[model samples]
Target: MNSVNSSQNNLLFTSRCPEVRDAQWVCQKVKNTFPHISTTKISAKMADIEEANWDLYRKFIDKPEYALLYNKNPKDRKFLRLFAWRRRIVKRIHDARESWRIGGKDDYHRVNNVLGQFKYDKLGNCGEDAFMAATILRINGVDNTCTAGLKVDGSFLDHMVCVFNKDGSTFNGKPNKNTIIIDPWVGMADFASNMFQKYKNVFSELLIGIKPQSEITFRNVDEVGISGMERFLLIMKHPELCYPNSAREFMRKK
Candidate 1:
């Protein structure tokens, strides 16, 4: 892993950072376009965020210590099945994100701080949140896909999330008939409808099933002043920053 990191860093920095550029553009646009957004609107956004955080905390983090005992016995098929079926782990991941944000972490989220050990002071953004959920799902022997994609008409593929099947089992290593998507980044809002509102016509099962490093190009990307190659190179660097729980555990074992 260290060797791989060395090689990736050695890749030339000839391209602009799409994430950084797009983020700055967004910030500037918001500042310029809505110099004085209504306090009511801001309060509503905060309310939604708070509601999601509250649900996650009550559902997962606020539970009694004995609740963990269910996970202690591997042979308890009923409990394990129940555990795997419900969205508790996903909620925990969401709780971590809320805690991280509330603690005032920076935008460039560091994944290790949240997943390996819960650090309220060091939080992660959407991608790290999704990766954390994916790690937990994988640990529980659940089938899921962690994805990265643009907001469909947008220039940057800046979000990441975990997509899963309604039934835990996969058909021939592919997602089964009914697929459910979970975005810890978006918190606990009705994810399906929220996703449709954000991604609209472009998000489909095809995006969920997309293989790693799949090529996708957005029209009018140059309008953002970043080329497609720059976006590609930027995304290539992101996965290296993610410190999934499995990787952290392996490091501790070493």
Candidate 2:
């Protein structure tokens, strides 16, 4: 039945149909992007959620989530930390195993924003991995940023990680310095570290000590694969690089 024009439930009318449709849309998007059932199932679960659950669903949004990450509430900050991570890699993996293994494969995709559940999450999928990581890091007072980076292969715009202006330098919240591109989402660390050491002058030319800006582009962080885990290992293997300050010196000038 058509919803009434004067209805107070505008959210219920036009938006409701699309929730189911979006689930269908997410299914199509995921299926088209990833062939394996393991990867594509995320879209399937996203499709299955009840429209009323949208409120909870939006909490998982990186766009709003990032803006709110700095809210003064200690509870909000702490929620980001505990759910993000209170332990190290080996321990995180151990704790995550039971949860990941829960419900067999189905629970994996159903697991959102809850930390350490998905393998691709390690590569920084947020709801899958990166989001959880950033949430935890922020809570720990590490100062982090979550944004998206396109692979430049195919049209898929993937998620990536970055440290905020302050976290990357001793400068503290001053964005004028070069913000490092740490692609935790893909494990890219995507900076040209070697090139910087070689050019050296690119240092002055690159960052110019100008306040840097970063963003997520609003795409939901959902990529899943073993590659994500590989990237996670690579990052853990290099805490100095992951630390943000060391990385800030190398954002590509051009």
Candidate 3:
């Protein structure tokens, strides 16, 4: 394993940060958005969810966790979906988006800190978005399970994505088959519904999915725009690369 200090110094202009700041941010979002939720004990209703529920997911997320259809799940489901990737999913995601800002929305989000780029293009910070998304969902009631590993088709490297589930309460008990994965960056609520007709839609599986359509846009870490979701349909339609173990084979891999 690599020392956290050796990760990178891309954001020398920034100050020190906590290892789990992202997790906290996620929790914050959940609290703010789902004002009605007071740590309620939502019975694990994985069965209530169906294949058509994904459309509702887009409305909750104001910006980007870059979540995909498969990523989001109830707490119980996250465990069943995540195998070895569970222990560090929350940590890795929070760390991935750790950084400082440089400019404004007009300017592209520059790298203040980073470990590796998915394709060397900047669409705000993917890791931060995922961390924020997962944290918010976890706190609000959605159980998000993710994986930090190589993609099977040589489309990308050192990647992470959420998988949905039926139940999502870690404190309740052992893991269950209630989680599923989603790429937060894939869908933009601002776009026409038909425009998003293609591209894998995985929101329907969860009790609730969040996307703030009115607040969707790519963010510039430096300026007045610290909030927004940059649409990257190009990612799913055409990924860069993946390893021999694609997500579909995640459980069966040797």
Q: Number of the top candidate by TM-score?
A: 1
Over 4 Å off in model 2, which ranges?
Answer: 1-113, 119-127, 149-156, 167-177, 188-254
Sliding window of 10 residues with minimal summed lDDT for model 2: 207-216
- Of the two candidates 1 and 3, the one with more favorable TM-score, higher being better, is 1
RMSD of 1: 20.0
Q: Write the per-residue lDDT of candidate 2 for residues 1-254, one digit (tens) a residue.
A: 45355333533432443222222222232223222212221333334452434543355344445624665667555544432332234355455555565654532233332333443434213223333333323332333343333221233333333333322443232223333333222222212222122223322232222122222122332222223444455345434323234322222211
Better of 1 and 3 by lDDT: 1
What's the lDDT for all of these models? 0.37, 0.33, 0.28
Task: Show where candidate 3 strays beyond 4 Å.
Answer: 1-123, 143-150, 154-159, 169-177, 188-254
**TM-score computed on alpha carbons, candidate 3:** 0.24
The candidate that wins on lDDT is 1
Q: How many Å off is the CA of 124 in candidate 2?
A: 7.8
Candidate 2 local distance difference test against the native: 0.33
Tell me the tens digit of each residue's lDDT in model 3 across 115-140: 12222222223343343344333323
